[model samples]
Target: MAVSRGCLCCVKYLMFVFNLIFWLGGCGLFGVGVWLSFTQSQFSSLPLSFPSLSAANLLLVAGGVTMVTGFLGCLGALKEQRCLLMTFFVILLLLFLTEVTLILILSIYHKELDEKAKDDLIKGMKDYNKNTDLKNSWDNMQKIFKCCGVSNHTDWHNSTGTGQLPSSCCRPGTDPCHRWEEPCYEKAKNFLLSNITSVLVFGVCLGIVQILALAFSMLMYCQILRAEKYMD
Candidate 1:
C-alpha cells in the first residue's frame, strides 16, 4: 500500500510539471499570435491580404484552448479530482485526434498546398505597390528569406514598370548590387519545403506528449475512484 501511494504521488507530481510546461508553451504561442495580428493591423490602410493571418488566428485559438486544458489538468492532478481529470483527458484526446488528422491531411496534400502558397506569394508580389502592407511583407520576405520574385529576378521586370528591383533583392555591402543575378522563388520554395520535416516532427512529439498526459489523467482518475470506494 505504501509503495502504491508513493507511485501515485510520483505520477501526480510528474503530471503537474508536464501541465506547467504545456501551459507555458500555450502562452508563448498566444504571444506570437497577438504580435503577428498587431503587426498586420499596423498596415490597416493597405489592401493587403495576408495568407498567414488564418494561421495566426489558429495559433491564438489553439493556444487559448491548450492553456485552459493545462490549467484543468494541473489542478485536477494536484487535487485528485476525478471529474476534472476526466474532463482534461477527454479534451486532450480530442485535441490529439485533431492534430493527427491535420498532420495526415497536410502530408497527403503537401504538393497542392505548396503550389497554392507559391501562387499566393506571386500574387502578393504583383500587388506589392498597391498595398503598403503587401509591400512591407514582400520586402521582409525577400530580405529574410533571401529571395526575390516568384520564379526569378526577371519576374520583377514584368511587375515593375520602371525596370527597377526592390533594394531587398540586392546583396548586403554592395552599393549597386546586380538584382537580376539573384532569384528568390526557388530559394524560398526550397526553404519552406526543408522545414516541412521539422514541422512534422514537432507535431508528432506534441501528440505523443498529449497522449501521455491523457493517460496520466485517466490513471489518476481511476485511483481517486478506487480510494473513495475503499474509504466507503
Candidate 2:
C-alpha cells in the first residue's frame, strides 16, 4: 500500500517547486497591491463605485490568499501530512471553482458591466471640479490614454462648460487647447479587449496548475494514509 520511493520523490519535489514559484508570484502580487494602494490612495475619496479602489482591494485579498495557499501547499508536500495535504487540495479546488465562476459571469455580463462602468465614470466626472482626488485620477487617465471624456470631448460639456475642456484632453501646442477626439471609455475598453486573449490564457494556465496541484495533493494524501495504516 505504500507509495513507491521514486514516485513519492518525484511528486514531492514537483509539488515543492511548483508551490515555491506560486509563493514568489504571491509575493510579487502583494508588493504590487501595496504599491497600488499607496499610489492610488487619492481614489479613496471617490464613491465605492469607482473601479480603481476595488482593483487595489482585490489585489490585496488575492495576494494574501495566494501566499497562504502556496505556503500550505509547500508545507503539506514537504511534511507529507494527510491533514495539510487535504487542506491544500480543498483550497485549490475552491480557487479553481471561483476562477471558473468569475470567467463565466464576466462573459455573460459583459454588456451590463460596460454600462455600469460608463455610468460610474460619468458620476465621477460630475465631481471633477469639486474633488481634487477624483479630478487628478481622471486627468491622469485621460492624459495617458490621449482621450477626452467618457464618450467624447463633449461629454465634459455638462461638467465644465459648453465650450471649455480640461487641459488634459487637449493635444500639446494648441493655443486654444484643441481637445482629443477619442472617448476615454472606448479607448479603455478596446485596450482591455485587445489584451483579453492574454488574460484568458493566463487564467487557463493557472487553472491547469491548480488542477495538477489538487491531483498531486490528493494522491500524496492517500499514499500517506495507506502508509499509516500499513504501519499500524
Highest lDDT scorer: 2
CA lDDT of 105 in candidate 2? 77
State candidate 2's TM-score.
0.81
Q: Write candidate 2's Cα lDDT for 1-232 as tens digits.
A: 3346567778888888878777766675576668767755644564444444555576677678878998999999999888898888888788768867867877899688767877877777788988888888788777777999888777788656657788889898988787888898787556545634553565456557677777778877766776677679
Model 1 CA lDDT for position 22: 73
Clashing pairs in 1: 148-184
| TM-score of each model, paired residue for residue | 0.70, 0.81
Best candidate, TM-score: 2
Find the 10 residues in a row with the least total lDDT in model 2.
42-51
Please write out the lDDT profile of model 1 over residues 1-232, one tens digit for every residue: 5665777788899889888877776676677667656644533332222334544576688778888888988999988888889889998888777767866877799677757765665665677678777777667666766766767877677766558788888877777775535455566445434634554465456566677788788877777777677668
Question: For model 2, how big is the CA root-mean-square deviation?
Answer: 3.3
